[model samples]
Target: MRSLIRILTTVKELRWYYWGIIICSLLTAGTALLTPFIIKEATDEVVASLQGRGGGLSVVIWLAVALLLADLANTIISNVGGYLGDVMAARLRTRLSQLYFHKLLTLPQRYYDTALTGTVISRLNRSITETTQFLQSASNNFFPMLLTLVASLAITAWYSPWISLMLLVVFPTYMWLTTLTSKKWQKLEGEKNTHVDIAGGRFAEVIGQIRVVKSFVQEKRELASFSRHFDATVGLTRTQSRYWHSMDAARRGAMNLIFFGIHALIFVRTIQGVFTVGVMVLLIQLVNLAKQPATMMSYLVDTAQRAIAGSKDYFEVMAEAQEREGLADPVVGARKQLAPGQPMIEFREATFGYEDGDNVVRGVSFDIAQGERVAFVGESGGGKTTLVSLLLGLYQLRSGQVRVAGHDITETPAELLRGSVGVVFQDASLFSGTVRENIAYANPDATDEQIERAAREANAHDFIMGFEHGYDTLIGERGLKLSGGQKQRIAVARAMLKDAPILVLDEATSALDSKSERLVQQGLDRLMQGRTSVIIAHRLSTIASVDRIVTLRDGKVDEIGTPEELAQTGGIYAELLALQSGSKRDRKKLKDFDITA
Candidate 1:
């Protein structure tokens, strides 16, 4: 009930539409109530004419015309109310969708670290859709039903208070019955949603990585897993449906017994001349009108449960802590200039970790002077990427500070800090779009000439022009149509187009062949010309040209020196270099340090 109320309150901007819907619904209920009264008047007049006490055929004809007009009015009013309901529902959906999407954008990066793409998408679609549908149903039905119940009872009481009292008893009886099942039904719904989210999350993951699944021959395994989740939902549905229908049957049985007793009393009253025939007709019609709400009680409860469950999910996500960077904050056109003589990037005693994990980067302090080039050389899981993530402000440090442009990152807006740095990850991470769109992703306003210049600098111009459409050529998702090297070059071009003050190349060339690596390395060299660059590479050869190297071991800095200096330290970097050499003596020496290639 609270979730339903919250859903309505969240959309207070649409109050005018809600008012329109309410007015139309009340008008609809008023017209429906007028119906039984019209019929009673016509019947009474016809009986008077039969007894020769009526004004004549003309009086009956006019009453018949009154009935026709009332029915016509009811038809028009009902349609108008329905149209208003539809408009209100659509507007509500639009408002809710905007809210959910905006929340997704503002949520912290950490929320997405463990969240699956499909699960997130599924939750947004399912929760909002369910909430909107229920709101629409309630708006169109709930008001009118309540009005009918109240008005019908009032009129029935004027004729026979005993019948009115009987009609009133049905409400609490039905409500008590529905309330009994709501909690259990909601519990089952929550469990089912978990399974569905997992299934949907896995489905999206498999589709996104179909190549891996196909290569590993795990299609059957994935299909079986997907089927298992849905199958579990079916089992739950079987139990839920059985329980709900059984309870519904019992409620309906009780309603029948009450209505039977009410009708029996009405007949006895009329037969005893305690009420006239016209009064009896009106009373019976009112009783049936009151029954409508009672009959609809079960359906309303079911829909309300679905909406409540969905709204809980929606609000849970909305409640997540958003990053300091507001979605509306402009990342571009708001770059903070570096203070003179300040390091372009600085990590001062920085410490960080993933959720529920030990620190991945601990007490790591480093500085890169303006226009200086540096590289981090370490094995996998050595905290190299974790450090870069911290530099980008993707995760908050557990202790200490990372400064960008002489401003502590924690004190600065994340947008301002990230806006000054450009990154090209190993995966390229291109969206499905035209080549030109991909290059100008960061700076959408980049001109054709500027885009071409960046592409050329990244060594991607010739290959892109080789396509039939040149820069306008379509690249499939993540640029799947392009080779590994081609994707890497485009990623570099995108970073180049941003033209930020700092650049981080994270294993950018580690996935390419020798020929492609050399071509891409040439572009990297050109891109790094005068920027403060940070490179993370597993292969030691790529960072040899860097002015200094920072080698990490177990999340702490093990060595910091020029390539020549680090080569003789017999540290992690030297041991890696030795393993790369593949000589018998170098291999034997690596064993002394407990290092493995």
Candidate 2:
């Protein structure tokens, strides 16, 4: 209930619309209440005329017209209320979606490390949708129902306190019955949501990686797993539905018994001459009007439960700690000036790891002067990428500090730090968009001339022009329409456009054929000019020209020197160099150092 109220309050800007809905609902209820009185007057006139002591047919005709106008008014007003409700609901959805998306953007990278993409998407869609629907329904149905119940009871009590008392009895009784089942129903709904989210997550995963699944011939296995999750939801639904309906049946039965007694009392009193036939008719109609809310109670409860469950999920994500970087104002196109003799980039005793895992990088320290090209080379899982991630401030270090441009990254905003660095990874990570858009992603404000210049520098211009649409050509998701080399070149073009002071290339050429590697490396070499460059490479040949090489072993720096110096040190770099050279003497020497080739 608190979550539901919080969601409602989130759209306070739409309060005027809410007020309009309430006013319209009250008017609709007013028209409905007027009908019974109007009909009663008409009936009483007819009765008096039959007894030859009435005003005439004129009175009845006027009353009938008034009733018609009232019905018409009710229809118009109720439709207006529904319109307001719908507009408010849509706007609320827009606001809530924006908030959720903003929260997602601000969340630390660590949160995403364990969260599945599909699950995250599923929760956002389901929770916001459910919340919007409930709010709309409350504005449209719940408000009007409450208005009708209150007005009906007031008029009824004026006519007969006993009948009003009986009508009031149904509300608390029905609510109590609903309350009994609500917690249980919500529990079951939450359980079902877990299965649904998992299924949805898997569904998206399978679709995204369909090629891999097909290659492995695991389509049946994936489908079975998806079906099993939904099947569990079905079983939960069966139990939940049975429980809810059984309780609804009991509540409805109770309502019927109470209304049955009320009807009998009205008939008895009219027959006893304690009330006129017209009065009896009015009382019966009011009782029926009061019964509408009772009938809708079960549906309202169901919607409320779903909304509550979804709101809990929504708020859970919102409650997560957002990145401190997100709190700072964006520092766009504003590079912090470095002092003289300061390293362009520095890592001092930096130690870091993923959530609750052994440290991937420990006590690692390094410094890079401006315009120096350095490379990190080691076996896989040597913390080469981790070191770069720390430098980028993607994850907070467990200890020590990383500084860029002489500013401690812990104190500086990540946006400001990242704005100074350009990165190109092994995978291109292109979006499904135009050739122009992918390159401009690094710098959204880059002009067509600038974009083309970057592409030309990356050697992607000729191939891009080969497409019928040229720069405007739509790349499929993750640039699937392009070859591996094409994607890598486009990624290079993106980083080139960034034109940051620092550049990091993580195995950027490792995934390419020799010809492709040569093209990408040429582009990379041009991109690295006059920048502090950090290269992570598995292919030793690529780093032969770097000013220095840092070799990592077990998350610690084993050696740091120029390529020539490291080639003679007989360390990890030397061992790798020797293995790549395929020299039998170096291989025999590696055994003396207890190193496996």
Candidate 3:
């Protein structure tokens, strides 16, 4: 019962389109049960009268027409019910997909990091497909079956109350058996879903690293691993199929036994003259009508249970906690929230982590004045990235505060903060779109002239125009068609177009050749002319241009000073610069390939 309520709740969220069909199906079931009476009348009045030489031909014709019309009514109602099922499935799919996409926009970054991509995709694809079909069937098919059961019982009572009561016993007994069988099937389905998810995740992982597998001669290994999961999926599915057929055959046999018993009973009663031939035929037809609903009842229980489980998963995603919002009565925009001419960013004893794991950034405090260019230099896993993430409102602080542009990031709306900051990472991600579209992504309202200007400033326009499609060519998935340097240049152009008050670069030029790096450095200098910039780089020469350097170790700031001042101190920053430059000789010995080539 609770499951039914949950399934209905999901259905109710969609606008009612097939609900009329449900009403029509019930009406048709009632109309169909009336068919037996017409058949009985035709048998007694039409055929019997012709042999007896008493009644007129008109009685026979009228009974024949009545039976014909009952059949026609059944056909029309069944067609309506089928049409409604299609419409309901269509609407349910659209609404559920929309809800899923909307929920994705609010999920925390940590959720995405920990959850497999294929698991999320399977839930939206396969799970939603099953759920929508089940919902449509429950409304259009299940309701009609229930109505048929009621109408069949009523008609049977009119013929023989004792026989009707005996027939009614089949309904509850089959229902109980169906419920038990369906419960077992639901467990198998859950197991089947788990294996299916594993298979999808494995496939996605293999495809993402196909080049690596081939390079390492591990294709056979990957195939063998994939085959193992595929076998598990098939094994579970075949087990489910066998169980389904066995239960189906058993239940069908039971129904047939009741059907034959009713027929034998009617035959004996007719022989004893307890009922007329027409009355016996009517009871037989009624018994057959009862079977239709009884069989459907079993299927309805199975579908209902599957849909119930699917609905629970659907709502679980919908009910995920959303990102927090600011107070209702609050400061308006970024400018209004921040004090006039104060520092653009400040971290006051802030601490944070991805989850319950060890804190990645702890007790970090710093302030960046307006228009100041600051650089963070630290070893890998030294919390440099975590601090930038917190400043961008990607993760909330556990204690203390991180203020951006004078407004607390945790208390401020993320949408507003995102607009005020432009960021470029080491990966330099680009969507599958034209050069112009990718550059203008941060500011969709950018004019063609503004796009060209930004591209020129980022030193990407010359190479972009070299292509046959110029700015119009598709970049393929994640800009795979372009060279690494070309992708990074486009990313730089994107940051330039946003023209935000703050710019962030996390090894943005590390992928470029020396010449290209020089060009990108010039562009970065121009983009950061007046904006406050925070950069993270391994090349000590590149970050040396920033006004101040901040060095971190083990989630704590160990030192901060001007580039020359830090270099003079022989502190952590000086040691890093020495270590990075010492590797320059080895780096130069490597081949110089232009990432844009």
Candidate 4:
């Protein structure tokens, strides 16, 4: 396939290994050819004259020794080829993993929003694994089998032209049958893989929402649905396996027919004195050599399909439209932030969307002074998240630009932008590692004192030290062992350690109880000192202290002013505030008489 060819071209760097393994494999085939000659000579020359000739015994002994040496040589060659194949496989796998990792990091954020998490994980894990497996076989087994077939046919023709011609007749037929079957199976395999992906996606979704399922008491229904989907996947795999096994069986039967017919013709010729016994014996070896290539037809066909599939998947990942970086035509730095003064951020008429004509944030404009604190507020589906995403340079603007300090985000190098911005999402995630490692992730080289200071600034130090292992305590996957508030605090600590001048907090306090929220707010106040902060929150009270408030509607700015100014205007913001205030009052009144008593 075109995809397969592209993947093969990408691996041109491994050509040396390919050649090395090819040489060893061909040498092994040569040893196999020598096998027939040794057998034929031992039979006719040694056994026939043993009753009379004195030199017969010694000839027989040398011939036997030669056979042993040839077999040993073949074994050594095959082993060497296998070693080379394995080494090449390991190298390719490492390169692939690194490529996928880098690709995932560099792709635009919209890609993540659209693709399923499990599908990506499976592609990176199983898809690449399948490709590597096929590569190993292609080098070690497939090439050797082809060489054996060619060498055996040439040698057969030298001994008996008629038999060689017959083999040639069967070879093309065998190849045709194998190729047709492989093509069919290749199509089936693609379908099977799709079903597998669906099953994986469903399984992952269920695991992720286990809490909801439990709350709804829908365990029985969930289990039944999962079983049905899993069974469907199994059915597809079973069909593929049956087809593959049947193809192999048919190929084997065809091979046996050709093998027997060749031997019969050769034996009949020997009876008519047209061939010597020694040559007849040699013919037998030649016939087997001829069959060696055809016998491996099924395996080769399967390997080819796997290689094609693997390459297709590899290129699918590669074919993703990569994010383009700004050119270096004009040497002027578009944005600069590392100066000794305050760092300011400005969005000049910025507009953006994941796709064309679907603007999620249109004509947005804002400016944060050196150390000003601003908060974004709106109802669900507002552009608060999109705006924050743009500020972090995860998504490029359709029109206008964002400047960090004084540099345009697009023109600033990716690494430089990442180093300058720190963000903590509403749902905090941490990798499986020690508490200390998670806190110090942003500043890996930070000393213990520095790490503790950052944690204190995020109000995470007290609870972390209370653990049995203190900073050494391990957090499970995604920091599942830690509570929501704990995770947020650790995330804040990480951001603090980075010491970036710009911070974006997305509902960072939503997960905390009142007591924890108060403690974290104190630490946040400390961290926000002298830095530009962008806060996104549903609870307007949380952003009451900010210098300015920006309310979004649909995908555009609906209002921008101080909290007091927005409330006095009796607009959308005022109505929402009054509704929340009245709801809170009613809840308090439900228990008001108890305080008087």
Candidate 5:
């Protein structure tokens, strides 16, 4: 009931179309039910004419004309009602989709982490379409059916009240049956959707991580897993379908019993001379009209239940609390000239965690002064990424505060703060677009000259020009066509072009080969200059001479100093350096690469 009400409220704005539908539906019902009475009048006129009653021929001709007019009106009204239904269905679908997509964009990042990709996509794509179809079917075919049922009963009761009593009693039983059957179908539909979600999520997860699957030779195992879910989904759906067939059969059987019994009663009454031919015809027509709603009861209930069941996930998404709005939008159009002094970025005893868990990064404090370069070097899973996440305002702080340019992260609008910070991640993600567009992503409205300059600075100009279409050539999904260094360089160019006051380099060169590493390292050096930069340092050599290095141990800040000072102390930072020193190849490469200098 709540679901139906929600759908009504959503489409309430388009009530005029519904009003149009209602009017046409009433016209259609009136025209159809009136046919039996008109035909009976014509038959009586003919009988009188055959018997040589005076004035019979003229009355019979008028009666014939009336029946023909009723048929034409019925056809026209039905067509108009159907057309209005189509219009209402279209509006419902379009509006519901808009609501869902708008809600999706406002949800926080954690929602994506916990949710399955396949389930999310399915709900977004199919929920609105199915819901509106059910609503339209109800309004067009099932809802308007009441007009036929009600008018038939009134006319029949005028002739014989006993028959109307039987109809009233039978209506409730069918409705009860429909309600009971619908409850079971709704649960089954939910199970079916769950199985489908698993299958789709598994397929997408495997494909997206195909490299890992191939490396580990687990493709056969993954296929088996996916097949199991698919088979289960099919088996369950078949069972549900069989159940629906049985209910449909039951509905039809019930309608037939009512039709035959009514006809039998009318025949007996006619023979008794208590009922005339016209009264019998009216009863028969009314019985058939009552059957319209009964005949469609099972289908109407099933479709409504299925649509509501499918929307379970869709409603859950809308119910999720949206990310808080930031205090301001990005300050663009004209660049602000920032005066250099003090820490541009600061954290004081900041802490954060997921859900009810203990803080993943705790009691951390640091400062990046304007135009100063700093690196955070730590072992894997040592809270290096958490600190970066805090800086980016990806996670709300569990305690304390993260201040960017003297504004608390929570108070500052995300886009406003992020606009000043350009990030280059280790896993460089590029959309399917031309080289020029990809580089210009940071500033979509950047001029061609600005794009070329950034490309040259990142050392991406020559490679971009090498393509036949150059900047116009299409890069495939995730920029798979480009080599590792080429992708990294483009990412560097994008960040550089933003020309933000703060720069973040998240393992920018760690994933590249030795030759590729050197090229990418050069690009990073140019991007880091004259800005407040924080490097999530993995390759220790690159940040050996940075302004400072912060070493983390077990979610807490352990040490902070220059590389030389930390190496001399034999602290956590020294231990990390020693671990890398044992690898002579890493040592030689570090020596060859002078990235920070």
Candidate 6:
């Protein structure tokens, strides 16, 4: 209930919608109860007129007018109530989706690494959908049914006490079974949703990595894996349906039997001159009111329970602790921005590990003055990439200080810190967008001339123009339409267009052949000319002209100096160079980085 209340509280802005539903619901309930009395008065009026009593045709006209007014008002109010409910549901759904998506962006890097995109996507969508569904059922079905049920019983007791007394005897058993089935359905729904999401996850995983699946020739294996999830979902749904239908069959049968039993007793009393035609009419209408709620009870509970179960997953994500900007000073609403006199990049006694007291990067410190090109080279898992993560404010530091443009990284806003630097990763990730959109991704406001200049600097201008649409051509997903070299060049071109004060290139040329490598290297040269550049050198040749080469071994800085200077030291850099130039056996050792000459 608290969880349900928390979900409701998020839409405080739409309180008017909720209030409107309640007001209309009350009016509708009142009108429905009045229906029995209106019939009773009409029946009495007709009989009295037929028997030539004091009442005449005037009574029938007044009763007809009252019934018409009540029904018309009820119809208008119910329609308005339904409209408000839909509006509230839409607002809640949109709000929840925004919350989930925004949280996805704010969550730490580790969350993404461990989380499956398919599973998360399914949960996010289902949570919002289910939460709104639950709200609607509660408002439209559960609450209304309950209110109507109470009013119907009172009217039944007033018309015929014996029938109402019989209702009291049967109500408890009906409610007990309904409550019991509702709980079971909720549990089943929760389990079914989990399996359903797993099925969605499997579908996403197999399709997203279709290239890998095809290369591995694992079509049969993948299909079998997907089939397992599908079958489980089907089996659970079948069981749930069986239980539901069986319970419904029982509920309807019992309610109908009770209904007829009361009817027979009423008929007997009427034949014995104990009740008039008007009284009989009122009893039938009142019985039907009771039966309506009784019949709908299971369905309403099923919808409500399913909704609550699904929304649980949604609200769980909403409650996640959000990461906020750390202030340099204890001042309210003071955001950290670029402060003057900070180094282009500085790491002081920096030590970091994914887990506590376990450092993957230990006590490493470095400085890259403005416009200096430095390269980081190391064996795999020696924390070459972790350093970039630290500088970018992607991870929280275990200890020490990382300052970027003079402001502490933790103190600076992540968006501003990243905006200050341009990056070209080896993967060459591009969206399913046009060439123009992809190039101007970082700076959407860049002029056409600036975009062309960046493309020319990247050696991508000529090839891009070769397409009939030029910059307007669709690149497809992750730029699949382009070759590896074309993709990397475009990625570099994108970085060039960003034109930040600092640049980081992680093995930017590792995947390119010699001809493509030379082209991309020239583009990189143009891009890195005046920026503070950091390169993670996978190939020894790529870092030959760097101002300094920082060697890392076992998570600490092994050595730092020029390539020529390190070549003479017989250290890790020298050892790497020797190994690369050695026999075929030594070549396999550095194959991960693919730095062959």
Please state every model's RMSD to the true fold in angstroms. 2.7, 2.6, 3.7, 4.5, 3.7, 3.6
Candidate 3 lDDT, 1-597, residue by residue in tens = 465455456668544555577678777887777787888877777556667853778887777788788888888887787787777778778877887887878776766777688777777776677777776776666767667777878877876787787787787667666766777788887887777777787778778777788999998887888788778878887887788778877777787787777778889988999988788888887787777777776566666666766666667777877676655323223444456678888989988877789888889998898789999877678888888888887877898898777677777777777778889898988998888899999989999999999999988999999999999989987899998778888998999998888889888887778887888888788888888899987576777678998888788987889999999788777665555456766444222211111
Best of the candidates, lDDT: 2
**Error in Å for residue 445 of model 6:** 2.9
**Residue 73, candidate 3: how far off, in angstroms?**
3.7
| Candidate 2 C-alpha lDDT tens digits along 257-302 | 9999999999999999988989999999999999988898888889
Q: Cα deviation of 480 in candidate 2 (Å)?
A: 0.7
**3 against 5, candidate with superior lDDT:** 5
Clashing pairs in 3: none
Better of 1 and 2 by lDDT: 2
Clashing pairs in model 4? 334-407, 335-407
Which ten contiguous residues of candidate 4 have the minimum total lDDT? 588-597
What's the residue-level lDDT of 477 in candidate 3?
Answer: 76
User: What are the lDDT figures for the candidates, one per model?
Assistant: 0.85, 0.88, 0.77, 0.77, 0.79, 0.81
Encode model 4's per-residue lDDT on 1-597: one tens digit a residue: 565455556678878987898889889889988988888888787647965653667888999999999999999999999999999889888877788878887787778877777777767777788878877877777778778878878888887777888788777777677676777777877876666666676677778778888999988997787677667768876887798888778767777787788899888999988877888988887777667667776766676776677667767777786665654222123124345553477788888877755888878887777677898876566688888888877888889888887777788766677677778877887989999999888889999999999999899999999899999999987898998888888988988898887778888787678787777777777878877789886455678799888877777788888888999887556656666567665435423111100
> Which segments of model 6 are wrong by more than 4 Å?
54-58, 140-143, 154-175, 178-185, 238-276, 326-342, 355-358, 592-594
lDDT of 2: 0.88
TM-score of each: 0.94, 0.95, 0.90, 0.89, 0.89, 0.89
**In model 1, what are the clashing residue pairs, if there are any?**
none
Model 3: CA > 4 A from native: 1-4, 11-15, 53-55, 238-250, 326-337, 580-597
Residue 416, candidate 4: how far off, in angstroms? 2.6
Q: After superposition, which runs of candidate 2 have C-alpha atoms over 4 Å from their true positions?
A: 326-336, 583-597
Q: Give the per-residue lDDT digits (tens) of candidate 6, residues 9-124.
A: 87688888888888888888888777778998899878878888837777888888999988888788777778788888888888878878998888777677667889999898
Summarize candidate 5's per-residue lDDT along 1-597 as a digit string, tens digits. 587667767668988987898898899888988788987676655656677873666787787788889999988888788888888888888887888888877776677768878667767666677788887887778766788899888888888788887777667777766666777778888888787778888787887788899999999999999898889878988988898778777766776777677778889998898876766776777787887787787777777777787566667777898767855535332124434564687889998887778888889998878778888866566788788878887788888888877677787666777777899999889889899899999899999999999999898889999999988878888898999899999999999999988889888887888888888888889888887889886566778768998888778888999888999888766766665656765454334221221
